[model samples]
Target chain A: MEIIKSPDALKAALKATQGSVGFVPTMGALHIGHKTLIQAAREANDIVVVSIFVNPTQFLAGEDLESYPRRKEADEKICSLAGVDYLFYPDVSDMYGEDEVSLIAPDVRGYILEGTSRPGHFSGVLTVVNKLLNIVRPDRAYFGRKDAQQLMLIQTMVKNLFMDVEIVPCHTVRDSDGLALSSRNAYLSADERGEALKISRALTKASHLVGKGVLESDRLYAEMLAVLEPLEVEHVAIVNRAFTPLDTVEVGNTIILVEAVVGTTRLLDNVWI
Target chain B: MEIIKSPDALKAALKATQGSVGFVPTMGALHIGHKTLIQAAREANDIVVVSIFVNPTQFLAGEDLESYPRRKEADEKICSLAGVDYLFYPDVSDMYGEDEVSLIAPDVRGYILEGTSRPGHFSGVLTVVNKLLNIVRPDRAYFGRKDAQQLMLIQTMVKNLFMDVEIVPCHTVRDSDGLALSSRNAYLSADERGEALKISRALTKASHLVGKGVLESDRLYAEMLAVLEPLEVEHVAIVNRAFTPLDTVEVGNTIILVEAVVGTTRLLDNVWI
Candidate 1:
């Protein structure tokens, strides 16, 4: 596959293509999760463009931006294996500059749960995503539901901004033990890796409870919290598809999310019923 | 010309057209100023789309948003006369919703001059302009040089966001008396209209000094200030095309701007050398 580094090169490459384009944006250290997104793009569109940018803006101060894993050589091999047409790898200078206009996330929906723990995170995601989307101009863009809130906010941004692209949400990929695949999972030790499973377990438990007709949000949250008791639970939130908190869970319109610190690594997982 | 009120209808209408589109966004009350923009659009592209939105976000509290002049019939007639293919007229609800993401103007450049006198004004302008640009997806969008700062910022937004549209900066329209044309000119009484000529006259004086090799910015600013005497001058700024203040005038790369209040009406005028 073709590896493009500059925005201009990618633009030139995209312009030369003559069919529907699909895009998958990611931060590099590819896993099975990323592969699934690429696979979907490969099957649907004549041209597939994947961007691997470790966006510094999305990471809060004192976060792991400095030490985020980078497997450039491996990533290039994976893209070729995945049948990618163009792999866009832009540097920081290629993406941002001094004195730039920025996108601000919605105040109310942008600052709860994940946003509460890491303020201005979604804004950064949105700003970079907007830049990428404009640059790529893909007919369809794939995003994993692993970041459910992020997925929701991005869809909202596309609609609100009147961008003419389809945002396809793919299901979250997990390990055999039900641990959600994340690049940050590299930070976890063998023990913490096992502990990370508790997050998904909590989500699975909440899903099972909902399947059995336990509709009260408070009870579902309490039961999930019990499963995540040993870990440092950041939040156990039950909300509608719009991310608004609900007193009672409504099946097919509810999502249960959990975030917990297992050792030094922060892990998150959610289930939609 | 076909008039479209809803965003979906406008999208459908735009999609049905199959050629380069030229867009002119305005707040109705069509005059020679708007006619110039539409005429330029008509001459340049196969399809011309005009949007008349009195954006509330761009108006500050008690800033006459509710009382802004809107001549719908005249505007429609003007568009048809100018050979516009479609006219988009969306209500506030069609453009905005609860808990929406927004665009923030650059901190340093966006908060100077007109932005200084009216805080957060450019932010609103940038936000709405971004929305309109994305919605219409025009091949070329036109703006007047009368609002010099606004034109510059919109150009900056398009460049920074990597939006795929050309921004054509048109010459500022003027009356026989050399007064810049503006819809707000409708608010001025005969005396106020006579007093408003000072703004353009100041710009003309600055132009004359630059023509005579007066290179110092302070000298140019002082001469312009004298021309705006007895008027409540807001600011007299000498800057490069980038809007950064310059110590010495640079021919072909300079802009002289003036803003003054005549009675209750605020008037602005500028010249690019």
Candidate 2:
């Protein structure tokens, strides 16, 4: 697990390795979700590269750019134990410059659900993902389905741009209580952590309702909203695989998503039916 | 040369070729200028790919996208003669979809010069260029300096995005009468063709003045404007290699650009000192 800091050095190092490469890009403070992505990358390719870049461009002005978790030593240990061939940890200066080119997310798909709450968030995700993909030039890139919209958009970007890398989406990893693991989970206080479980509970309730033959989107939304209760829920959307609004759940094609604020920390979770 | 109509086929074909690829992307109507670009690619790399895509996004609503010059058979023959290994010719449908991810050029640099007349032009250029580069995966891509600003922006895009390809800027090809070679020259009548000579002539005057050590940008612009009299000149800009406006030319780091409307057709030419 050789840790590389510069983009040029990573490119140079990649050129020396003659095999299929699998990459998992993360923002440090590695959780089980990130580990799942890394393990998937490790199993699939001869070379596994993990990039820990908490890209600043992805964070909006009021967002947690400064307070974002950064456990450098722990992240290095995780990558080393996961058998990562290269750990690319670049500074903000190393990745970006003044007056840089950026990407714009699609009008319809990018501005819905999560995009609605965070307007320019997907664009920032896309720009940094593009830069990382270009830098790694991986044969396959692994992404956890925890960030469903981001994973979908990245898949769209790769297809639209004709980028020559396969996008492998790993299933979302969660805790025993069903709460989706996130780096932002670090921000939750003891009582706030208990409140966050309602997010996963809401998603689970929606899945149970679907299993009991309740397929209508409105019914599912209503039931999930009841589960969310007095929490400041951002949205409870029941959409198909393409993120298109569905009148009724399409069984295997449906995904029930929920976002809620637990104290000051916003938590997200979803269940694929 | 193998003519690949689909991007998938081109990528598959390129994978079989075992060396560095040099690419030249054009809009067909392969004149001496395109031929010069292909020749430069042939001299540099193990494989040469030339794509003839008259990208519709780059053209504004009222612009001549429909009337854009295209000569398929002639362009094919030109590539064959120039020793091009592959010629990717994808349709608009093959290249784009209804909802797509796109690149946004740097605000300050992308919205000036040609961008002022045709807003959102560089975004389209950057998007298509990014797609083409990803599709072709060229080691070195060639561009003519006739579109000086475009060349600069593309270079900036490549650098800012951390793209791996080397951008090689070729000298602008010219006619015996000193008119810059362009596919759009096909739109000009005999009288308009003669009037187009004024664009190159103005650039020549600027270059000659700079040669004589008259470094003041204002004096050079005035002289070029005097030579371009009675023409619908868009702009006479004296700037550094980075396209930053200059009060005085920096000798080796200077570029004098001229854009003029020869009758109904817009013509562009520049001299790099």
**Fnat of each candidate:** 0.83, 0.88
- Residue lDDT tens for model 1, B1-273: 899998888888888889899999998998999899999999999999999999998889878899999899988998998899999999999999999999998988899999988888998999999999988999999999999999988988888788999999999999999999999999999988888898998888888888899989998888878888889998999899999999999899999889888887778889999
Judged by whole-model lDDT over C-alpha atoms, candidate 2 comes out at 0.90
Instruction: Please report, in order, the local distance difference test score of every candidate based on alpha carbons.
Output: 0.91, 0.90
Query: Model 1: what TM-score?
Result: 0.98
The docking quality of candidate 2, as DockQ, is: 0.87
**Candidate No. with top lDDT:** 1
TM-score between predicted and true chain B, model 2: 0.98
Q: TM-scores of all models?
A: 0.98, 0.98
lDDT of 2 at B99: 79
What does candidate 2's lDDT look like per residue over A1-273, in tens digits?
899999999999999999999999999999989999998888889999999999887787888989999999999999999899999999999989877789989998999998898888999999999999999999999988778888889999999999989999889888898778999999998888887888888888888888899999998888888878888998888888889989999999977888788887777778888
Mind giving the per-residue lDDT tens digits that candidate 1 earns over A76-102?
Answer: 999999999999999999999888898
Per-candidate DockQ vs. reference: 0.87, 0.87
lDDT of 2 by residue, B87-138 (tens): 9999999999977999998888898888788789999999999999999999
Candidate 1 — what's its lDDT?
0.91
